[model samples]
Target: MLTILAAIAPNFLLILLGWLLRARHVLDGPFWLQTEKLTYFVLFPALLVTNLAEARLDGLPVAAILGAHGLGITLVLGLLVLPLRFLSPRLRADGPAFTSVLQGAVRPNTYVGFAIAAAIWGPHGVTVTALASSLVIPLVNLYCVTALIRWGSGGGKRGLGATVLAIAKNPLILACVIGAALNVSGIGLPPIVGPLLKILAQASLALGLLCVGAGLEFSALRGAHGPVAAVLGLKLAVMPLAVGALAWSFGLTGTTLAVTVTYAALPVAANAYILARQLGGDHALTAAIITASTMAAAVSLPVVTLLIGYLP
Candidate 1:
């Protein structure tokens, strides 16, 4: 247990440190904003492209990983999010609120997942993490966008073509596609491009966590007891367990298994709130879910990490 704590502490502490720095105004708002933009567009995509390009994919259980992740998410949606879509209008005063809750439950913070996986399993963990991201990013976006269109006030006005366009334009997904192309084609990263991407990738983990911390909206949590709790339960608890069990059933073990669970255990994506606003879901509720899930994951992830060793 202590070993697990030792491994995971720095990542969460970086988040706390980010919160502290932001709270203290150590760096002004504009600097953090630009840092976030840099990490999202340039640094993190470099990490994805670099890792996916060089990863030892031939030996990996690609099919099992895909199955476990896809099935696990579909399971959750079938049991929870989808049902809520049918009922959110009558059951809840704010019908669009379900979209935020749904996003909170399924979408994961890949930045945090990457940092934690790297801390725990080094290069292999990061590779598995990227592999999971490649799958999870598109899957979650499709589900969330569909849910938002059905439930969010303004989302129904947007065409399916626009959603398709947005997902195609997503930087991380594009990086994954490009990297996989290079890997499959056996072309690989060019000598110069590989080294440059490595440098940029190296900068993403720390800055990404800091941006996560700085973006947290603690004030949003107040008076949002029910939705926040629902999201935390599904995201921090149900999603990881379901994904882990499915992955295990598919014969994943050791670092690969651990990283897959880590992917699910991650908090809701920081971008969900932005999506909520754009789609006219309850953006305030989305913020609450993000803050609540992030704080809860700090404890839940360590426990999950410690328990990973005991899995059958």
Candidate 2:
């Protein structure tokens, strides 16, 4: 247990540090906005491309890993959407709020997942983390965009084509595709370029965690208690357990199992709020969900790590 805490503590502490720095006015809103943009567009993608481009794919359980994780997410999407479809208009009336519930239930913080996985399992762990993200990101985005279109106010009118275009243009997805292509093609980056990308990848983890901390908003939790609680339960507890069991059933073990479950257990991504705002979803509820789930992860993650350790 202490070993698990040792792995989990620094990640959450960086989040706490970011929160503390923001609360003390050490960094203002605009700084964090630009920082987030830099992390999302430049640094994080560099990390993904670098790690994945150089990853050893030999003997990796790519099919089983993607299948297990994908199945878990697909099941969760149905679980949330189907019941909501039959609910009273008053409960489901707000399009944006419904979108928030969807985002909160499924999205995982890739930045945190990468950091924690690395801490626990080193480079092999990061490889599994990146691979899981490559497979999961597109599917999660597809579901969220579909929810926004079906339930969101004005944006739903854009139709399926726009949603497909948006997912295609996502930087993270593009990075994943490029990186995997390079890996499979057996092409390596030039010496100078490799070092530069390595440097950026290192910067990404620290800066990304801080940005996650800065994005946390506590006030949004005030009136949205019910939705907030439900999301935390789904993201932190239920999703991980479901995904872990499915992955085990598919014969995934060791680093692959650990990384898949860790990703499942992560909080709702900060980008959930951004998607909510852009698509006219309830950004406030999304923010609250992100904050609550992230805060809950400090406890939930250690428990998850221990549980996976006990699994065959």
Candidate 3:
């Protein structure tokens, strides 16, 4: 237990520091906003690219791990669409709200997942996490955008082509693609290039966590309704359990299993609100879901760590 706490504590501490800094006005809102932008567009991508490019891929259960995530995500999507989406009277009455719920249920904060993986499993774990991100980032974004456009009161104006284009430009997906390509090609990282991305990757987690802490919206969850509660269940609870089960069936265990479950268990991506606002989904609820899931994760992550340890 002490070891577990020690592994996880620094990541949460950085988040707390970010919140405190934001609350105290040590840095203005715009500064953090730009910081997030830099992390998203720059540092985070560098980290993903570096890990994927350099990771030892020879012995990994790449296909099984991918299948587990793909199936897990599809299972969650089915649950969201058939029962809650089509059958629930409350969600039917509020399309934008439903989209927010769907987005919250599917997206994950990679920053948190990456931080935890590095803390618990080191570089090898980060490599596996990045490998999972290769698929999850694009798949989740595509699903979220599709849902928003279909159901959002203000979305779908640009049509499906535009949606494809948007996902194409996503830095995370691009980074994954580039890194995977380099790894497969066997060219490997060049001298200067390797060092540059390593430096950027080192800065990614701390800055990203700070941004996450700064963005917490405690008040948004105050009157949080059915959607928020449902999302909490889906993102934090159901997703991990489902993923862990399916992953074991698919032969993932130990580090791979834990990292995949962590990915599934992470809070909604911090940037989900941006997509919600732009696409006319319920951005407020999205914010609320992000904050609530993040708070929920502090407990849920530890539980997951302990539980996975008990696994053979």
lDDT of each: 0.87, 0.87, 0.88
lDDT of 2 by residue, 1-312 (tens): 998899889999999999998999999898999999999999999999998899887888888778878998888778754466457363467778888888898999999999998999998889888888888888898888888887887567776788789889999989889888888888855578888988899999999999999999999889988888878888888888888889998899987898888889999999998888887788988999999999998898998898888777
- Model 3, stretches more than 4 Å misplaced? none
Residue 293's lDDT within candidate 3 is 88
Clashing pairs in 2: 96-281, 96-282
lDDT tens readout by residue for model 1, 1-312? 887788888988898888889999997789898998899889999999988888888789998888898999999988986676566554265667888888998999998888888777888898898888888888898888888887789998888899789878988889989888888889889999899999999999899888888888899888888778878889998999999999999999987898888888999988898789888789998988988888988899999988887775
Give lDDT tens digits, candidate 3, residues 123-222: 8789889988988988989888888888998788967888788889989899999999989999777799889998999999999999999999888987
**Residue 164 in model 2: shift from native, Å?**
2.6
lDDT of 3 at 67: 85
Q: Which regions of candidate 1 are displaced past 4 Å?
A: 86-92
RMSD (CA, Å), each prediction: 1.5, 1.5, 1.1
Clashes of each: 0, 2, 0
